[model samples]
Target: MSGSDVRMSAWGAVGLVAGREVSTRVRSKAFLATTGVTLLVLVAFTLVMKFLGGTGGADATVGFAGQTSVLEASLKATATSVGQEVETRAVADEARGREQVSDGDLDALLVGDGTSIQVVVKEELDAELRTALTVLAGNIELNQQIVDLGGDPGQVNQRVSQAAIDVRPIEAPRDFNGEQMVLGMVAGILIYMSLLINGQSVAQGVVEEKSSRVVELLLATIRPWQLMAGKVLGIGAVGLLQMGVIGGVGMGLAMAVGALTIEVSAAVGTVVWLVVWFLLGFVAYSLVFAALAALVSRQEDVGGVIMPPLLLVILGYVLGISILPGDPGNRLVEVLSMVPLFAPMLMPMRLAMGGVPAWQAGLAVVLVAALIPALVWLSGRVYRNAVMRSGAKVKLTDALRSA
Candidate 1:
């Protein structure tokens, strides 16, 4: 056969092997059942969160005494603005209001003495209530100061209005407060688990094939690189499919519970980045795993061989969590997020949190994409050199020499 014909034949064999692996995994009952169970669990968790938040809002009851019509009106408006239906009760006296609060009949008591305002609660007030009251009190105090200083109320109001500047976001703005945290956490967990599960499958498959001598028969028809590529592609396909199902279920639950809100568009963009990065990360890790698997004839040595990549994955996750609450634009965070190994976890998080510049995100993705080919080439060389050897355990030096 001519060189081109030989290359075409090899590519065809690789496609066939990959196709078989994909088909086998897709058709497995285990995959279907796991997907179904996971979807149900996610839906249940979303429902629980929604119910808890709803209940928390419903449980607050505030009493007001000695408050003027203006103060009451302002409090009501503020509560309405934040989507809270405050249970506002008019109390005849401060003593009664404080008594009700102490007895738990009222969550909090708002007392206005004309010159000063006080909030009396059983203990800690609801966070939402506290925030609303604080803003309202600040406005009231400012207006009083303007009147006391002989300034026109209209002019004071205009100054206050002008002081309220629109908060322009430096990065792409997200509509939801905590959506980035949820998205980053979910994506990181999924990627970490998928890598560990799928990489182990690749290692086990290699060990099993070798132990059963099936690899010898397969090698006659396919090159080591083709076998490795097929396994990686097949498993990668399965991982993507699983992630798609999870994403669909999560989106559905979010929408059902109003968690999606205006942030759905942002979340969709994050997921797109997640899938792209996941593919690159999987290839980098899986190739290394496949190569390591080839170093041992027995399945037992697979764990030890896979340790370095696993440790890297763990470290990435730990660092991602550590830096999440801090400035994502910090030099250390930026450096970590751009590195190929940690980019899979950190870049997605930084993107979701509105921390990364567009150019930096683009550059990080490109850098990771560029690393995959080098990793594949190195791993293929390692596999070809070590797969045929029978040994207790192959040292890295020996493997490199053989390669």
Candidate 2:
């Protein structure tokens, strides 16, 4: 066979092995069950957040005294504007309102004494209700001042209208603060969790193959690089499929429940970037994990092999959290976000929060992409050297020297 034919056959063999591994994993019941559970939890949490955001309406009882029916109507209108459903009760006197407030019969009592207003809440009143009462009182006072200055109530109402703010996200297209934070946290968690889960799987698979003396038999049929590449790709494919299913279900549920108000186009773009970043991050980490796995001949040595990668993931997560609330343009943050190991966590967050410039984000992506080939080359050398060595755990320095 020609050299070209040999290369093609080798690649074909690698693809077949990868396909077999992916098929085996996908057929496992654990995979299906875990994906379903993840989808359900994501949907349920999103719905709960929507429910808690006053989408279902409030059930607070408010008492009013020393104000006419017109004033009560105005108060109700003001409360409704702030997403509160005020069940207004006209008290016979301020004393009666105070008594109701104290007796737990009312959430709050509003006493308007001409120019001054007092809001009385029970010690057990809901914190949200108390805050809303304060806000409503301020609105009332502002309206009174407008009227005192001969300003029309209609004009004041127009001036004080609270409309929904439409968010046009530049990089990551989350519609609200909840969605932005949720997506960022979820992305970071998935990166960390996937690395741990799949990395362990790779290590355990290697140990099992080694302990069972299957590696010697397999080595006769395929090259070591092909074996390693096939395993990594297959497991990476499984991870991607699981992530895609969960993400699609989540997006649909979010839209259905009105938890997400962003445009579908924008959401799709964000998911595309997520998948792109996941692939890059997984490839980089999984190769290192597989190389680490090959360094140990026994299952007992797996922890020592995997600890460094796990620690790196944890450090990235901590750094991502700390930088999330600050300006992403800070010198340290920019440097960390560009580092390939930390980029998966920090870059996604910075993108979501509109923290990173487009050029910087592109540059970070390019840097990560450039680093992958070097990592792959290094990991391939480590795996070839250590996979055949049968003994105590191999040191990282020895693996590098072997390269």
| Winning candidate number (lDDT) | 1
| Worst lDDT 10-window in candidate 1 | 172-181
Q: Which ranges in model 2 have alpha carbons more than 4 Å from their true place? A: 1-8, 55-106, 118-176, 322-331
Clash list (residue pairs), candidate 1: none
RMSD of each: 4.7, 5.7
State TM-scores per candidate: 0.81, 0.77
Candidate 2 lDDT over 1-403, as tens digits, reads 7766534467776787789879998999978888888888888887887787646555688787875444577667766766777788888998988898888888877766634556678776666666666675676678788899999867867765754579887767323354666666666666666666776777777776766778788777888788888888888899889888887788778777888776787667667767877788788888888889888888888888788887887788788776665444456766888888788767766665444567878988998899989988999888877787777878877987884
lDDT values, one for every candidate: 0.79, 0.75
After superposition of all CA atoms, the RMSD between model 2 and the true structure is 5.7
| lDDT comparing candidate 1 with the true structure | 0.79
